[model samples]
Target chain A: MLSYLINGISLGSVYAIIALGYTMVYGIAKMLNFAHGDVIMIGGYMAFCSSSYLGWPPIICVLFSIVVCTVLGIIIEKLAYKPLRAASSLAVLITAIGVSYFLQNAALLIWSSNPKAFPNLINLPSLQIGGTQISAVALITIAACIVIMIVLTLFTNKTKMGKAMRAVSEDKGAAQLMGINVNGTISLTFAIGSGLAAIAGVLLCTAYPTLMPTTGAMPGIKAFTAAVFGGIGSIPGAMIGGILLGIIEIFAKAYISTQLSDAIVFAVLIIVLIVKPTGLLGKKIAEKV
Target chain B: MSSILSVTDLNVHYGSIHALKGITFEVKEGEIVTLIGANGAGKSTTLNTISGLLKPTSGKVELLGESLMGCPAHKIVEKGMALCPEGRRVFSQLSVRENLEMGAYTRPSSEIEDSLSMVYEQFPRLKERSKQTAGTLSGGEQQMLAMGRALMSKPSLMMLDEPSMGLAPILVEQIFDIIKSLNKAGTTILLVEQNAQMALSIANRAYVLETGKIVISGTGEELLCDEAVRKAYLGG
Candidate 1:
């Protein structure tokens, strides 16, 4: 039972990291950004190509991958979302899906179909403490997740750029009128969110030590699910949802079965929705007439 | 003294339906100019076109003698014109403070905090609810927040669409009074209103629009006393 609990937590922590990216983007844009998940896949592969294929040092590979992912994210925003912004939501949604598929397929063409072993950056070191053995890598991921969340919270709320983002999300026209460079702010959001996803990809791939072109799809979906499970747009809520979902999955997997683990987690989401449509931490928005 | 904005023979279409029909107007610095009209009089479209939210089919939009006809909305912002859009499209999830912060997104790092404090002083009510979500405010409060958010940008020209929209009669008076006061304090305002009486009362100049055409252009008093405007809009 203890083992299952720890294992679930390790997996859940990853889900939570990926979910943060989604929550942040949605909080501002009010669109799901279907391409976001694929961006994670791109990040993972970029790391793989940089570290293993290019034979670069692990740290350099991660840094370069992050930069590349951020640039790609910004490009995606400029080309895909910005152009379609004036169109209906349906058009934008379709565009997002298109971008997702295009990235995944493009990744397939570049990275090939077979699974690649992600270099064990930390090599799965384990320690026994207080009668519980925890993998150092999992602990690092959890710590990293917490640190990223706090940093992002501070970045969004305390920094001038972040304030600009909050303003644009609140009212684009007004934000622009303030000379806030509304377009630049939104593009920055995509870049930052995608950069975070890149880090999550590295952490996730390290924990698992395997890669597939479509690996990001399932994890991405799960992260998005985590975001919605908490509250689609709340930063704290996404983190909380991710941890809770991870714990729940751990318990369910241990008591039930791994195949049913995915189903159980999704079922819990449905149940949560039935109880609170806004997710666990989501506040209901009152429409101004 | 010179035109801060000039729209000459501006034409806009909503997919082949000529919405703004060859509209022409100019706003001077330190003046509160209003465009008064009934429903669907293309008042908002004129502002949207100037602000680059909508592309005019055929027209020239010049600000400070420079062309603004082809600029995007964000670029238009950089040129020092802000639009306090109709319907108070405040980021519903963001706090009132964040909304104001967005208004200065493009400024250099040095100016952001100063602009923020300036907005706070203008609307103490916003300061009280600075941490509250903007959408949660009452209509009058939301309007104030919207106007406050726009002011945070420190624009050379500020255009507001219907500051009196959907407010209690008393609140409408308070908002217009604020507009007049802001103008007196040296903010050039281009106002649009269906409430012809209140709008014209405060406007230095007013244009009476009819179905996308500017039928009359005169001083605010001219619009208020005009037989057509008084009978059709100001309830005789």
Candidate 2:
């Protein structure tokens, strides 16, 4: 049971990281970059190429993936999303879907459909705690998630650029009036979010040990689900939502059935939405007269 | 004093609707200039166009002899003009202090502490509620926060739109007093208000906008005593 709990937390950490990307973009840009998951897939491939082909160290491989995805995210935003700024939400969402497909097909062409074995980036020995053996990756994943959350919270609260982001998220026109470069801020958000996606991709593939063109799809959907479950736009909410989702999925697989776990996880989301429509931490936007 | 901001033959359109049609006005350094009009008279539209939030269909806007046409809103702010928008559009989720910090975004980081202290001194109520979320503040406090936020940029020419809207009569007087004091301290003021009496009382010069056109312009005292102005707007 303890082993399963640790494994669950490890998986949840990846979702938490990815969900941060989704929640942040939704919060600031007010658009869901559904292609976000594909960015993760691209990040994983970048890491794989660096580690296996170039024989680079693990840290360098991780940094390379982050840089590539950050640049890719900015390019995608400039090419695909920027033009749709004034368009309707429905139009933006459709464009996002188009971008997602474009990325998937692009990856298929470059990397082929064959799955690659993901190298274990963290080679630390397993730790034994309370009569249970926990893998180093699991421990690292949890620690990394906590650190990312703290760093992000501080960045938003303590830095000028972060405060500008929050201001833009609240009111674009007011933020602009304050001399904030609204476009630049949005681009930065995409950059940060995609960079985080790279970390999530590396962690995810390290745990599952598989890399393929479609590898990011399931996890992306689950992380997005976790984002919504936590009250879509709230940062702390994403962490809580992601961890809860991981535990629920693990327990459902253990006590129920592995085949039913995904179904049960989604069922739980539906119930949460019905009970609290805004997710766990989402504040109900009150309209002031 | 030289003209701090000059708008000549300015026109604006909201799609098919002509919002501001060939209106011209100039605000001099160290003077309170008010634009007074009834609802849907393009008062807010005029301010928005000048601030670069809305593009003008035609006309020239100059700030300190520099043409402001085609400048983005943020760039315009860097050029020393700030607009305290209508509806007190404070960042509701942000703390009052954070909202103030956003106002100083155009200024140097070294000057932020000084600007913050200045704004806090101007609106002591805001200082008291600095840590509170802006959304929780009452309407009057929100108005003060908006004004204080604009002041954080340390703008040379500050434009305020409907600052007294929805405020209690006593709060309206208090707000006007702050505006008066701010102008006295050397900030040029361009004010838009439906409260014609209060607006003109503090305005050195005033323009009356009607259906997107400026129908009357004069010294505040002259307009206040004019039979036509008293009959139409001052409730003769």
Candidate 3:
């Protein structure tokens, strides 16, 4: 039971990180950013190529993954979303779906459909606590998620750019009038969210031990579900939602049946939606005339 | 003295409907210039175009003899201009201090403390609730926060759009007093208001806008006594 819970938490941490990318982008830019999940696939592929082809160390590979994703995020914003900023939400949503399919096909063309075994970075033995063994990778993942959450919280609260982000999220015209480089602030937000996706991609591949073009598609949808499960725009909500979803999946798989786990996870989402439309932490914002 | 802002043949359009048509005005240094007109007279449109929020169809805006064409709103602000928009658009999710910090977004980090102190001194209510979210503030308090937030940028020229809107009579009096003091402290102001009485009384010069055209322009006292202006705007 303890091992299942630990593994659940570690798995949930990756989802939480990916969900953060979705939530932050949505909060600041007010777009769903459907391609966010595919960014994880790209990040994982970059890390794999760096390690296998370039023979780079783990630290450099991680840094390279983050850098490439950050740049990709900015380019995606400039090319795909920026032009449609003034267009209807439906138009932007369609464009985002287009971007997602574009990324998937591009990966299919580049890397093919075969799954690759990910290199094991951490080889430490499992830690035995109360007769329950926890893998070293699980411990590292949970620790990294907690640390990243803290850093993100501090960055948004105690930084100038963070305040500008909040201000822009509140009112773009007013933020521009206040001398905030609204475009630059938005670009920075995409970069930060994409950078976090890189870490999530790495941690996810570590636990799953397999890589493919379609690997991130399920997790991406699940993380987005996690984002919605916890209030869509709230940060801590994503973390809680991801962990709960993970634990529920594990418990359902262990006690009930593995085949019904995904269905059960999604069913829980429906119940939460019916009970609270704004997720758990979301507050209804009245439209100003 | 010399003019700080000059607008010539400014025209603005909202799709097919022309909002501001060939309006011309200038605000000299050390002056409070007010644009008073009835609703839909394109008062707010003029300010928006000048501040780079709206694109003008055709016009020339010069600030200190430099054309303000094609400048983004943020760059216009960094050039020592700030707009306190209508209806007090404060960042409701953020704390009072954070909202004010966003105002000084273009200033150096080393000088933020000074700007915060300056704004807090002007609006003690904001200081008392510096840690509180702006959405929770009362209408009067939010208006003060909006004005205080604009002042945090320490703009040389401040433009206010309907500052007295949605405020109580006493608060209106108090806000006009703050405008007076802001002018005395060396900040040039361009004001747009439907409350012609209050707007004209405080302004050094006032322009009467009618259907996007400037019909009359003079010192504040001159417009107060003008028969057409008094009968149309003032509840005469």
Q: How well does each candidate reproduce the native contacts, as fnat?
A: 0.79, 0.72, 0.79
The deviation in Å at residue A171 for candidate 1 is 3.6
DockQ of each: 0.58, 0.71, 0.67
Ranking by lDDT: 2, 3, 1
Model 1 per-residue lDDT at B100: 74
Residue-pair clash count for candidate 2: 0
**A4-115 per-residue lDDT for model 3 (tens digits):** 9998898889889999999999988999999999999999999899998898998899899999999999999999999998999999999999999999999999999899
The candidate with the higher TM-score, 1 or 3, is: 3
DockQ versus reference, model 3: 0.67
Candidate 3 TM-score to native = 0.98
- Steric clash pairs (candidate 1): A170-B91, A178-B103, A178-B153, A179-B106, A180-B105, A180-B106
**What are the runs in model 1 whose C-alpha is more than 4 Å off?**
A287-289, B109-122
Model 3 misplaced regions, further than 4 Å: A285-289
Residues B1-236, model 2: lDDT tens digits: 89999999999999999999999999999999999988999999999999999999999999999999999998999999999999989999889999999999988889999988999899999999999989889999999999999999989999999999999999999999999999999999999999999999999999999999999999999999988889888999
Give the CAPRI rating of model 1: medium
